[model samples]
Target: MTPFSQNMVSVSLWITVVMLFGSLCDGGKILVVPVEGSHWVNMDILIKALHGQGHSIDVIRTFNSWFVKENSTYYNSITILNTSGMDEEFVEDMLFKMIDYERGKGQMNAIQLYLHVFKAIHKTHEMICQLITNIFESEDILKTLKEKQYDLMLTDPAWGAGILLAHELKLPMVYNVRWTTTGEGHFDIAPSPMSYIPVTGSGNTDKMNFFQRVKNAFSYLLMDIQNSRFNLPLYQSFCDKYFHPRVHYYELLQGADIWLMRVDFVFEFPRPTMPNIIYIGGFQCKPAKALPQDLEDFMQSSGEHGVIIMSLGTFISDLPDDFTAEIAAAFAQLPQKVIWRYTGKRPSTLGNNTLLVDWMPQNDLLGHPKTKAFIAHGGTNGVQEALYHGIPVVGIPFFFDQYDNLLRLQERGGAKILSIATLNKNTLHAAIQEVINEPSYRLSMQRLSHLHRDKPIKPLDSALFWIEFVMRHKGAAHLRTESYKLPWYSYYSVDVAVTLFAVILIFILSIFLAVRYLCVKCCSRKRKTE
Candidate 1:
């Protein structure tokens, strides 16, 4: 080739490389404040995706975090020493109590249960107060964080600490959330009519009878009262202290630029949603990889009978001895092989067919062809995975939001609910049998899987694009609504309604007065002529 042609080819290759690198990432700096446990699990997925795209991420965590690691390849950690929220011991104790209440073994009544939950949630907020106080009080941490100059805040607003920091930094905020500090994420950003939209923990579907609607309204009211009384006050104090008095914490939360909701309309009830709210449900799910040698062999051993998997998610692996025994007895009767994720002692009736492990590849097993059913605790991650893989569920919800999650599946004819309170060997076996033998359950779930998967782009890729969209544009402000800035009266249009009513009344009265004056004038003219 000629010398000019050779030089031109080299220049073109160099330009192509530069464009590829730019497409991968602009290296935008992101500050991530995530919640612990399952919340952290999903957040980690997003962090890894961002890191792959060549963005810089810094995570804010407690010094002794339960799930978040201090050392990682993808992100840096900002550790707040010796302070934490969502105490495990505290939460687990309450979980067991709620289980007991459902079982009828406890003297705790409904009011008592409500109070117990309220107290636990309040205590969590108090710890949140201490955590944020530590950050705001420390001059060195504050000064250094300020110097870093992050582009945006990505947080799980399940706690309000992230909200405060985003505002403190004056950076745009995005939420990787299903719930916020006070309630469900949708209620914060969207209009939720109690008549149709069931409140969390109500265990009612979108379509409700009169009594169910009443129950839904009551549940929503209870949450509102609990949050306003317990959750909001603790954070509101900080907003009052650190921000302008007029700036409420709720406003800061609702004013976020993007809400990357961890739920989708397929699983979630249909409701009005906002433009900035993006659904990325089941983003963590993928096609199953090869199982480990031992697990693979066990999976194959199940043969035509297939296998059933049970997991209670990240926390609460141990149940009462009787409860474990009941499940064990039920599993022993099954022709299918059982893999149960349990960290507790072996139950006396644990059968040859049953295998208990401290951990299992939950998603992989769910995707496996030999897998027939999932015995789940109704956690969002587990449920979403089951949906993605078309696994029918026999849901055994232990406590708090589990019933709500499972209800969605049950309503869709894809799952059955077996409460821990009434769970025994017979009930457990029957539930398992019902899901496995029932063709409708599997078919229902498979339909949902198709719906969830039939999208223009993968959920994770969509999430990445939106996150980068915020970074590229600085914030998704145009997509966000200004309703958060309005007062309640103005938002509901009460003032407008009252003004229109008054104007109509005045117009009617003016017409009446004109008619009366004309009648009197004609009568006086007739009397003068007489």
Candidate 2:
């Protein structure tokens, strides 16, 4: 061949290789839809880390303004899709109207009011469902999906709508369980121990007092009844519609390809976990960023004593006045500057040392050098953020998974739990001082923080790796278990075995009785003939 022909051939081969490499690098994009409130913070960290690793990420925030202000700037590469149909202002107005109705003369008792509130919220489920449908059915979302065709989707399992979307998109999906996903017996796919009613605990074990045992039993019974009343019908309907005709609950959980739980193995010990689940705690941690100018100035004014950062989380910002007053009284006595993130109107008699702000950048504030401690509601996200910053916590947990989270922190010696029911000025003051003055608590938190951050690959990298693994494998069918194929009786085993035993016993008894009756009748007939 001629020299000119050989040179041209070599250049063409190189061009083909370059083009293939670029195509491989592009891969596919992922769309993450996070649950409401601080959940987005964790989702944002995942997005940033994934993008840093060269995969495109699009975040569809369902509840936006409640967590972040409208005008906030997002980084250039990350696309923020805001589809929270009802904004914070609208929600606040609705809540105010409800509150006004409750405050009228001859209002009901606390229990009655709670029931009423529950009913009102229950009625809004349809509205929430409609909003979800609107977002899922949006032209923009469909256009983007059709354009890019996401390789996989990641979302919190609590949002059942994600499951529907995953099915619709025909994309591999992973459920992000932020807390315990097991039921009371560790055999069901309920939300979590703390979030579920009829709380399971060591007190119910063989060593408890009679009263304690009774209390635990009653609690469990109540939880069982409540769950049956509220969830059973929905679960049955979902199973009828989506799952095969007769799949057991346990089997349903085991069928999921992967279950990623946001729990540290260091904590949440003694758990009965399945092989498919991966515990990736501290996923919320990101590199320290500087606080906003206004927040910096406020911290600087706190002086040498340092500041106590108190945030009750986004959902419970409109707490009862009694609860707020109790918290205010506790803050009044603290020597350190109190930075309270209060969404409601300012109290009339708050102390001068306490600073009330409508909203503050929590992670940024926690990362601040002068921030001594965190007083939080023990949400998983809050716990993660506080742990990442090596800040000891004074946890005042209210409801849901907060109780378990606080217990885990307490068990790890990183924080102290103060019940909302028993919260008083003295207890609050002591708890704050214990978290701040106790060097052991800070040391323990720092140790865990280092451990949480010590992974060679960041959480986002791990998450993305698994996601790609699913895509490359065309869904990890091997990870899916056969348990979902079993019947309820066979899945539990006890029901079937017990029923069989009872049937056998009854059969033997019936045979024996039949023989005796025949013998007796024959004897009587012979005697009469004689």
Candidate 3:
């Protein structure tokens, strides 16, 4: 019971309290895994923002190799796994299967149906399930995660493994749907008068054309089937092995502390959102960085007519030769300098004003003062980058959500859309000129860009703040909602009530007609007998 011993004990207690307080107040460790291309852009911005706030960040990139060939840019703390091997195999297998299915069906069904099924199965079942398994099996990754004891995990909803990992670690997880999860989900999450899902049967309330609406409804139905058949079983097996018995897929989503969407409410006007989901739009921008030396020189040569940057994103670079030729021809005639990110071989008869590179630092280029406009495939990241930089876009969407994204951008008056299927030199040339010469497009983009930048805190800061908030609260269970637990019909309010009412009305009318006819027959018979 010496005073010296008591003082030593007091000092130890004080240090422990100080460490805990700092961890709680200064933002705790966060593990982020953004599976695909643009997801990385958002994650990078998030990490930088967290770093600025003195928080520790560890990023585990699942698909880094597909974008960057070298290991130069990856951070020392970041763990980049060779996810390419599995992903390529999965994609190839799924594509070949789809092709086979289409060939077998012949003219029985449209190829689009098969493609939709393939995407849903591959994305949700194969890729996501395998990713979860890989993370669980990787002793090194698990060990590192356990050691760091991350207070929160932020992940792209596309990477379903992130959900599983967060659950297993007993840490709070936030779903970051970088792109519109579903067309209607976008409308539901962030309602906009401009937000349209191609559905059938329209009034003024309808945004989609007739065929488009039918397609949307069919896509939703097909996805529901695919989830029930493929995804549910796989997810159930994982749940059975790791956690409680008979856990539902919906339960996993409902358990999440928060859902973060990378969509600006200003652009997605009249957004319909739940309490749990937060619209942290334009979270994808970083502080302006200088462009490459060669790029800068090329821009300087263009003089007053700034450059238009062209990229079809990474996945759809397998552009047909005819399309490439058309693009090349269009770029050749333009007075402005053209910087095209062509993944394939360079075209012949290249113009002096054009430059073709395998890839360019997109954000850096967009941030450049001389970059006037962007010609893109309308990927979420590309669109966000253009909006953030106050640069107008000429969107030529190819497939998937790109179509919907371009539509939103067009609705915002910040961009123009061109059909990829019917692209030509004249079309490309005109679109470019229109975007560049039209003052309204530029002004609209600038206005949106200002709104994006003028947020109380940057998107990243908001994301980090929420993560720490979850940690401080030890999980934000109150934020989760019961709506996810309801069936799809209940959620949409299209259940048995309407069906029952219709059936009862039909039954009553049929009975009344039959009774009236019998009474008339009896009266006629009595008259004849008399």
Candidate 4:
């Protein structure tokens, strides 16, 4: 063979050998416990990638979660934890009530929202605590867990139970989040600046005016108050029962080795991050696939007008009928074909242009060539998906981080944020038309998508690399920040601030005393001379 051909053959053979060896080395035991069903979707890419790499995967989830489907083939072992008084119907009813409360009667203030969410969190905590109590108080689940000898535990820190469970099992854990949950007692990574990064429900952007910044700061205080008043107490009660006396729930959270934060700068504002916090923002979203036959026919019929997809996510699918009718009326006026995800009663205002379905393949519709705009509830996943597909949005945010996520989109010219309170057929139609007709929104999203896809290693691969990196280094403790060890005062430099204040006080006191002494001496000399 020629010299060049011989070199190419050698390189190809070496690459093949390395690939085979790496696959063998990638095998490890992994356990995933997702408290919320929506989080199951977030873990899709990571779980699939790990499974493909030959890892043994196990999942434990609650029974009758609409968010998490029963797919035995997805994991090696699936454990369905059943809690009394919890069923699909009950969960759905709770969700419907919460949605109605938020979208229909709830106040727009952050304090009100925090209180509302705290009540929900309290109920969820109680249920999860009962489940944990049952598991530990009964059979030898701990014994079985110890015997499994899992290499790593990946958990969604929506609840404190997951972190405690991992610690009790003596396993290094990784926190995966759909949003930034650091300050909420999930993980202690780098703190995002309050001046720029708005708190979860603040509905403010990174660049805030003075009043907005004040509101944002107040939002954090409200969250802290709620967490302390409601969340921490429950977590403490659980920890006191299950773990050691000194095993503070916060300490257990800080023990996590890696954080897979679903953050991408394309949609998220620029913020500081630490070594262990991996940004695998859009990794969970699957690649765009061809639309199913019926859906394809519908989109093809739209032809020149294009299509608009409206999905409010899983939790708040059942909106109030009147509001749905108003939105439907707005869609009816648009020339575009509309695919609305509705699980409730169909609105009478729905027109020939609108197709209401219980579930529409969101990602596929976003990727379709004929798709022009998206009407969303400002969810992190929906916003990210829209940006990934480069589709402009008319965001009608209802609750939680939805408001904040859409604010970022509005700031970036990728979306127009429409408040639910002020929403009407005229307003909704105008917002949609603005985004659809305005080339700026579409152009902005296109740029973001281009930048998001321009990375050398895809986000999914980067996430997998870090997951294995943690495994390879046995928790990768060196990557963690020592800030977790520091107390709150020390972490925020409160102690340093107090020290500086004391030094300034002493200096001022000495200067005042010296000035008084000089004035007294001069007066005494003048009186003696007189």
Clashes of each: 1, 0, 10, 0
Local accuracy of candidate 2 as per-residue lDDT tens digits, 488-522: 67767988789999999999999999999999999
lDDT of 1: 0.90
For each candidate in turn, give its C-alpha RMSD to the true structure in angstroms: 5.8, 9.6, 9.9, 4.8
Q: Could you give candidate 3's per-residue lDDT for residues 382-420 as a string of tens digits?
A: 888888899999988654567667777788799998875
lDDT at residue 528 of model 4 (Cα atoms): 100
Ranking by TM-score: 1, 4, 3, 2
Point out the worst 10-residue segment of candidate 3 by lDDT. Answer: 197-206
Give the poorly placed runs of model 2, Cα more than 4 Å off.
1-26, 57-114, 117-121, 131-148, 179-255, 292-304, 318-326, 421-426, 438-440, 443-457, 499-530
- Residue 13's lDDT within candidate 2 is 67
| Global fold similarity of model 1 (TM-score) | 0.92
Q: Please provide TM-scores, in order, for all candidate models, with all chains considered together.
A: 0.92, 0.72, 0.76, 0.87
Model 1 pairs in collision: 103-421
Higher-TM-score candidate among 1 and 2?
1
Q: What lDDT is reached at residue 119 by model 3?
A: 59
RMSD of 1: 5.8
Tens digit of lDDT per residue, candidate 1, span 182-255? Answer: 78899987998998999988888899999999999998888888888768988988988878645798899898
Please say which candidate is ahead in TM-score: 1 or 3.
Answer: 1
